[model samples]
Target: MDDTSNQEAYDRIARIAQEVFDMPVVLITFMDGHRQWFKSHLGTDRRENTPDQSFCRVPIATGKTTVVENALGDDRFCGLNDVVDGPGLRFYAGAPLMTHDGFAVGTLCLFDIKQRSFAPEQVRMLEDLAALVMIQVKSDRDIGRVDPLTRLPNRIQFLLSLQDMVRADPGRTCWIVLVDVIDNRNANDVIGALGIDFYNEQVRHAATILKRHLPGNTVYHVGGAYLAFMLDGAQDTPHALIEQLDTDLREPLVTSRGIPSALNPCFGIRSAGLMEMSSPDVLRTVLSAAREARLSERLFATYNSDHDDAQKRMYSLLSDLPEALRSQKQLYLVYQPRIDVASRRCIAAEALLRWNHPIWGPVSPAELFPLVDKTGLIHEVTDWVMRNVLRQIAAWKAAGIDLTVSFNISSKNLFEDDLVSRLSEVLDATGVDPKRLEIEVVEDMNLDNSHIAFSRLSAIRDLGITVAIDDFGSGYSNLAYLLSLPATTLKIDRSLVAQALTDHNAAVTVPTVIKLGHDLGYHMVAEGVELPETFEQLRQWGCDEVQGYLFGRPMEPKAFESWLAASNKALLASA
Candidate 1:
């Protein structure tokens, strides 16, 4: 009713009122700011009226129906100039069009040429029509404000509520808790196992759970497998309830198919006190925090100052990563030297990624490399790594500090047919010997299309770049597929190497694996050689190469260059 001017609808209602009240005139007019506009009328064709000339204004102001059975006789209504003379309207009975909050915004009234009295039944009918009018107003306004799926107030309505909350208690804080299911990507698995209908049921179940747990909480399905609700006021402590929801939500949901689907719910709580941002901005920041928390391995996390700093860092890195890959700005490679078990000399070093963020200082590969997978920029990152590694090798040869570096490649990169050509272009452009480079792939990497991956790997091998199956045994791999892979080297995972130190079965498994590699004519590299026992056992097992802290840690380019010059086993660096 704030901006509504539906004359046709009001005309229909006025027609009904004319018949219902049996009055000479029936008009439905809404208070429009300081003036009153006639939505419909039976006796008059006029559209608008001034507030003083408005009979509807009295009912709107008083928030109750005005039964002016004798308008000229009533002292309160006699002030109107129209009532005294013009049209000489003496009878009036107006009903207030009230909103949900009890604010009367307009009137539905009846008038007659002569003074008249109405029965109680006619008054009740007038009130009922007014109620219908309010419903129409509210329904029209709520069209876009309500969610279609859950039949709840949507994001827009939530923001409106937030604004109301803020304006009502400017000094108080409001908290928004977001619940997200992380396994929606795997929701397809459930769909395949059961049916797509079950997925819809899961959402209903989640919504029901939220409503049941937090009775008055307004739950919102705010896009992308996320549900949110807000809590206000100081007395309402939500942290304990949030914790309980986190724990209770861990239970697997039984779908309509009677099959249980695991739910990984991550909760992020954001609070604001002493208003710093508008409702929309607050909602955006809160949901952004929820997304970051969902990204973490944690089940639940609250947005805080530290998370703010970390989120800034993460987005900054993500935003800059593409350009960093293309331009190689503030990015470089470090190598961890590997030792030969029999020759007791350096064989090669693993090329590791390092980033020196202009603002955040040195960022570790342990912290940075995962950004590639998350952004789906693994191909770009891999190309950048290889191009730089090859270029660095050529530069090292010129400096008389020759080294053969093994660079890691993501499965996505290995699967791409363009990868082999990309590496060939880098090798040819840099004029670096291809034999001096090795590309390593993790055994755990998804190889559903093994033939295509191996085809590309074999092509790279044919170009003289040896391939190593890295992190062997850390993740399960098919032995038959492993044997068929076009890899010449196998790097036993650090975990397996660590386990060999204590477990007898692991001790026995290590030698058998080494013997199998030897029989297959593949060189075996034992990583995580931290202790004397592990070192001696690996040496006895005839492991071709050993890489761990026992030899040398991953070092900066300059440090490794200097180490290459000083080490007696310079076979890897001065080849």
Candidate 2:
């Protein structure tokens, strides 16, 4: 029979063994080079092996099968039988794997205890399984090393080729470029439970594109979000390679449904001749540099001693983030006011995040947001915010204030299959009317167009709570995306409003946003109207609400309540 039919023989063997001995572990191994490697294992540990120094070596060497009922007392195996006498092993059986050329490679085998006699059915099964293993090994030997992800030749193949090149010219120089995706945790959070799968696909897609553009090279997944490329000769410079990789990877990979998502790539390049480094060192240094480049929030960075300090600090921060959120170290919240535009009355408040660093006093949201996002602490932080906000809102209710409070949500929270349900549970536990609560989602929720987020947001709104698009204009203009979202309010981003009074672009943006929002039948709120002029501009533009320092700075709950009570008394006295 041709080698391909061995698979059929193997399956037959496995079935026979299972039917006869009722044993789970069955494997076919072929003797190749220094090892007796497995072609397949059925109901057994895949690729599990006995070293060449052990008893199985004799059978493959002698082109025969071996069966020992109990190795401890069997003279042929007693000299080196500690493995079987070891825990969880007793009876042993093996059959030599035979090649089509009639060479004995290794064996088909079964393992068990209880000292049972072998059955004829199991013997024939083992023999067939052994033949199958041989067929698979022969097929594999013909194929060059290919990565399971992109089907590109892997690092092993590249190394072998590089060795050949080295023999041709002992002084050959090679450059290795390492590309990595930044903020996988954020990606996962944004993508929800299927985040890892999405991320892996993105990597493969990017690798495929890069492979087409690259010349005679292999890419390998050295670790999470990292791919290494080895370039031989001087056809491409490190900068050019980085530029090409950056372009290739930066292109958005839209889902089949046409939802666009961006993946940021950080590239690090190390060429030979600088430090006289080995190929492994070149790869390692480039990876380290790529990580440093990501940490610096740069496109890329070359390896340097100074970068090590930053990388160490970044990793230290990441490692401690979970503990920090769990403990009292760095997590907290700040409340900002949302005002009614017509009356300039503060009706609701948005919760902003604050990290009270032990030494730094306050870490900016720009830094801490990404840090928390990186550490998967967004949900933890958001949960704390919700519970704390509910308690504060409850206190405010008792104090005669019927004000609503909104908290910003990560996209992770928006698409969480249980998000609305969990929020319902929290409200049940807290007895806070979901009506008085508001939720603000980032304008770019990027739910991959999953109706899950829209449905979840709709559910929250159905609970009579308010929903708003926070940080509008911070993301690209996806008008259809905005219309498709289930938010009741649009909050103009601070960057847009910060320039409203002076910049013509900002002035046009405000009126246009208000007009578009009005046309959509949604309320509009302008954030960061620090100057009174900016506030008046939003009101004049017909924005329904405005929030910023012009009305009042974000205050502690106690201070905000005191301010509310004072305002109430002043209004009453005026009446």
Candidate 3:
């Protein structure tokens, strides 16, 4: 986001806040990039401060207003900057500048040079002023910010409404029901044949059904195919809502040009008695529970505290990952070599991302993938992996290794318009042959927009980059999808690799796939070949490449170089 526009808007807000508080310091502070930076300020020239000294961070981080009437007497503020040093700020009161998604981006704060206390009315006024700042900031993200098509509150408006809902009087109970609408695969196929307008019509009908299940002026088209309603004074228990919506949605809804079709709308319900809560606190919590119920018959889940903690932790991980990548030690790459079975040579290597969190120790990609996918952090992570992997390949060339490298591309990245251009530029800048870089795309995820994916892959292939379908047999195990793309390699999924050696079905299945790949002009690569028997079986099956722990475990860059040297020396000595 360009902060210039937000900053220009913040100037007016900061002036209003400064006038309202009649204090020496009134500032709009944004807590982002792991530090608090002032967006606009009066009575102080300082632009940014460490998190500890960021008075606004207290409110931003907690999503609660903070007041320190006498800063010097408070242990939390006594020794902090602006307390004992320059400006000598002694009083503080801040209201969290919350975004619609419920994240406290910063705080709208006033600090006096002398000790001061806020009356009840003054405090309420301060909160109202802070809310006004939020409204202006949200308006910057959209013009009036409501959906024209749905004629309902969009995600941003929903967020603003959520803040009000959670902050209402304690006796006014409120519930946030997120109805996630998904079309059945075949039903989607039918819709596709009918056209996009048909799908939109179905969603609109499903939304009406969702609105019927909830009460009073609360329905919102918060996200794609999802309707959200803030319910209060519920005459019925929240669980009852899931029953009726699920029952009504089982049959297909009427579309523009097709017969009525099923638009499965799942429900995730969360309620809070008037108490201070943040947007991420409520929305993400309910989402975690909803995901568990997505494939179930009930298709609805109420928020659980236990479930919420994990979601919170995941949020922290996503927030911290960018900083972790920038640090020296936390995020690094490891290479697992893919070997040619016939030649017994290291033919290629796959660059795997490894995050060694100081507390979590080792976080697996399996756990990391979904966390990032949901949080929309996957694209940046994919970019990091690609740039680093390509750079590593170039470095290897300089060191006389000249290794071919393949790195997994996140499913989310396939949709990026610049995906092809970014890869081409990286490869070109690194001076690495495009063929030496293979992009391992998860084939199943590409099914959603095969034409788009295929188009991007074609553009990528035009740059001489090989496209490999990673985990080919795991999802739906659909082999027909391969015929549509220009894939140079098919990674037989680890699960299939586990059984291919011993299981009769897999033994037949594995060789058949290898031949099919060969006939289709793709190199068949078996992933996760941890045993000699498995390696030998795969070699016998004419697997062109085998990548697994049996060859070499993923190692640090320098360690990989050392291991490669040692292995080549051993081969020469044996010869």
Candidate 4:
């Protein structure tokens, strides 16, 4: 009834009826309980009337053509306002709009001020017109509910069904499950390698498997590679179904094109009372759980509100991060002093990113960077840090403080073709000496693209910037691979530093790594040194720099400057 196409089609039929039967008025209407709603009205200004006063209601009730040759002569409708006072008198003819399931919901009708007889032939033609209207209605409904590819109910239909179920039994519990046949990345890879046809075949194959497993259940094609279905919480065991699917999906899927493909299917399930959540929210919650399963490499994951809430907060941070970078508000940098081991002087600091979210209070870099690494925004984040750090260096230079500041970047940034050039541009713009800036690359980065990473680091070194291998001993540590890089500094990982104080093997290995780095002509820095004894041990082992809470926690620029001044004074007095 809300569809304009339906109204336009009904209007066309109404006009045709008015011209054919030579009636003064024609109407297409639906019996809506208390009133008859006019979908199309011609040759008259009336929009609606009470069901008792409508000629269409009789056809809707009888499921056949209804006619009143003269309402003034008919005892039933003679007292109606249209016959008694409004239109004076009326001749009515209407045909019931019967659905395929044999239910009459509305009618197509004609009216005249003069008494006239509706011939049997004319009544049959009106019924055919009503059938045409039903045809359009059925097509519109199907187009909205059915998925073009899978021929199953679409997401819209799924939501509607869920709503209907909730309305019928608000307190009933149900399990909603989403199956991800393959991740987007692998799906794109397949599309690029073979074609969309092959990819679509895989989706269809997945749908077939789902339907075969859960007979009599409506499966929805919710996404490109996602199929979802709901099960009665009391009747069906979701875990048993999950286990069966896990075993079945482990087998390789061979497409019609004879290409064998491995399917890494993950399931996300949520069981909730119908009244507890809305349909859309249920889908979202299950989707989040499914994503978590894929990320954690699990066969299935049930919805956990804590995990879901954290995921939501993570997404919120990612969305807000770009604006924070642009405004420089909320996002700022703190520097942790890296002390010269022998001289006891602050020679450099590591610039770490911090976010004081207006609502979330403070977001940890530990939580932020992992999420950022998965998106293209990593480049924007890296660029923001680089530009801001350079500007801070220039500001410190203007204040007569010369300190080398280093910042970290993700492994993905190493493959960016323009990374060095962008850094060069920012360096030139800030007018800070390249010698004062350092780039710290993580040690455990995926080395599958080592050539590109090494080349990028080499270019940075050639540009007069220091390159440091960060988190050393935390990842695969190969001496030959380390020697092949152009980096001039190696920062011992905090985990190794912390263990060196307690573990016998770590204590022996820490000094060995420091000696190895020094022998290779690379400056060695020990991280997470929170004790005087750890500092003295590193100093004795010829570690060039030490950075940890023992020296000072990460601080704002002004606080760092004050701490540096006080530290230098203490060093001068001790000397």
Among these predictions, the greatest lDDT belongs to: 4
Clashes of each: 1, 2, 3, 0
Per-model TM values vs. the true structure: 0.65, 0.57, 0.63, 0.77
> What are the per-residue Cα lDDT tens digits for candidate 1 across 1-575?
54454446667877888877777788777887887976676888777789887777778889888888788788777878778778877889999988888888788888887778888888889999988787777776676677666676777777777787767777877777878854666777777976667766666677777888989778887755677887774656577887777666666877766777666777777777756335366665666666676677666667776767676677778788777766646888888998888877776889888888777788777667766665677877887788888888888889986667998888778667678788888888999999999999876536755677878889999999999988887867557645688889989889889989788878888888889988887899998888888899898888889999977888978898777667765665666
lDDT of 4 by residue, 173-246 (tens): 88889998887757877899999998878778788888999898999998788899998888765888888887
TM-score of 3: 0.63
| lDDT values, one for every candidate | 0.78, 0.71, 0.78, 0.87
Query: Candidate 3 on 1-575: residue-level lDDT in tens?
Result: 23565566778878877787787788877777877887787888888788887677678768998999998888878888678897888899998887777888878889888889899888888888889888877676665557665766777777777666656653666777777777344556755687667666766787777666665566777666677777665656666666777788777555555466777667778776655234445666666666656756467877778877776667677778988877878888999988988877887899989998887788887777766865567777888888899889889888888778998876667788988888878887888888788988776644554788778888988998888988878857676666777778899998889988678988888899999999999989999999999998888888999998897999889999888888888878888
Query: What ranking emerges by TM-score with the best candidate at the front?
Result: 4, 1, 3, 2
RMSD for all candidates, in order, please. Answer: 9.2, 10.2, 12.1, 5.4
The TM-score measured for candidate 4 stands at 0.77
Between prediction 1 and prediction 4, the one with superior TM-score is: 4
lDDT of 3: 0.78
In terms of lDDT, model 1 sits at: 0.78
lDDT of 2 by residue, 458-493 (tens): 899888788988888886656865678888888889
Q: Please report how far candidate 2 places residue 258 from its true position, in Å.
A: 24
